[model samples]
Target: MSLLLSFGVLVLGFHHLQSIPDSWSQHYVFVKFGKEHTLECPLQGEGISWICPHNARSICSKASTRQKTLHLPNLSHKKSGLYTCTNALHQSYSTYLLIDEGQDLLNISCTSDSYTSSVLHCSMDKPFTGPSLLRVRSYSSNMTQEGKEMKIPQDENQNFLFDIQLPNSCPSEELMDPIQMSVEVMSSHEYTSRDLTFYRRDIVVPKTPENVTFTKEKIMWSNPSWTPYPSFFPLLFELTVRYRNNTIVTKRTEEQNYSAKDVQTIRVRCRDLYNPSSWSPWSPRLNVRA
Candidate 1:
């Protein structure tokens, strides 16, 4: 009788462990809008049940469950949320569903003035005309920066600008890892969030080459004043020169000095040689003759 009672207690403890859900085992799924998606339960057995996304009333009601699998057809933004599947033992697994509309309403871009600058400038283009709230956040391996929630006002050109101050400059060792940037826009009837991941070298927009001087025989320019340790980071300079006969000549070189003749107008741009990024904007159009 004593042995029988000990076996019963052991069974009860195992049942209790099975009834607890595993919160750490979560998954994320991204499905395009107006598409079909299927979710499967990790546990296999009878008496499997699913708790569909709460926001999708229609889907929750119509979703078909066959054993450990859930089939969802004709997905929409409303179908985005947590989906949980539970077995007879009450062991549950959850998946967060994300619905992508395919159409991106926010045109976002990030650029730094120089490799050594600590500020990152980001601009978003508003394609739709309406009042909305915008929130931005940036994340590095070590830290997360949250931007203040602001109302997006009507702009003449439909563009909004924001800046993020990094804890370290672009070329610093701390920023060598990947950084994540996210933007969320919310309006009365719509809500969307976009995330972008990039490395520091990917967004460096060096300052425009300065002090462009041109002569009949050669043209010379100096690197941007903000460039620190110019010897360590080589630059590739591009020269566009127009001749007297309305002809144009474009040349690329690693050196700051170039030899040319019959040049009417000249402008220069530079980019990093090792980790090339977007070329700096053409130095203010320099007219050699005028």
Candidate 2:
């Protein structure tokens, strides 16, 4: 009888440990500066707490009886980092945060009286420790849809500043609105990933002149606003001159001009890489006469 009782006790303890439910684990997409990003951490039995980086420190103390959604504050480019959640029972779960460093909205303020070209800088400042992707969209009556995209090299700091040209080919009768620019960043870890979004308003890029002017250098096909369609001439409107993943410095070279048989309108359009829902209203239509 004594041997039988001992055997039963051992069996109960082993069963209890084996039957413990696993913790919550899933993929999460976090927006840059979004409100109250919720991360649900659920576990079996009692004692649940959210931890950042490791189990030593807890983001929330005194585990609640029910599943908890860790409310994260507005995140920035630098906020991209590793996160973990664990239960008091010694069981833990891990995930990564990817913050896309780009603009969610664009707000442009132009001087009512200034004469020289206004300087507009667009960038994403979310912190992501990986490669970055950049996409630019240009809108005009004559150009293609779904602006151009470029794979920006990865970096830990996701701040970027790019210069764009304005519309010049549109006729005076039709005034073109300022171009919109969006930036996005994503973070990666061995076990997780996260993304963030940002936006800039009223970014102005120079427009190419209508008159016939030829350049010695040949244009590349990878530009977002460039199209080689046979129906329309291979006219280029926007140019990306320089770029840096960390500093977010993008500069444009000297103005470019392309002469076609007829004149047409030119407009710049960009969409947020992370959140396409938050985009600026289309710029005023710019009309150009040949």
Residue 6 in candidate 2, Cα distance off native in Å: 48
Instruction: Compose the digit string of candidate 2's lDDT tens values, residues 197-264.
Output: 21221122322222222233322222223222312222223322211222222222223432222223
Give candidate 2's whole-model lDDT: 0.33
lDDT by residue for model 1 over 1-290, one digit each (tens)?
Answer: 22221111100000001021122121233355667866767776677777865566555555365356666677665565556677888777665554443336668989887767767898988744665567677777767875646666655768888887665434655345777877765433234568888876788888889999986588999999878878656799999989888899899999988888777888899998877688998998878764
The candidate that achieves the highest lDDT relative to the unseen native structure? 1
TM-score of each: 0.58, 0.28
Candidate 2 wrong stretches, greater than 4 Å: 1-38, 41-52, 55-57, 60-68, 71-80, 84-130, 133-151, 154-174, 186-290
Candidate 1 local lDDT, residue 80? 55
lDDT (C-alpha, whole model) for all candidates: 0.66, 0.33
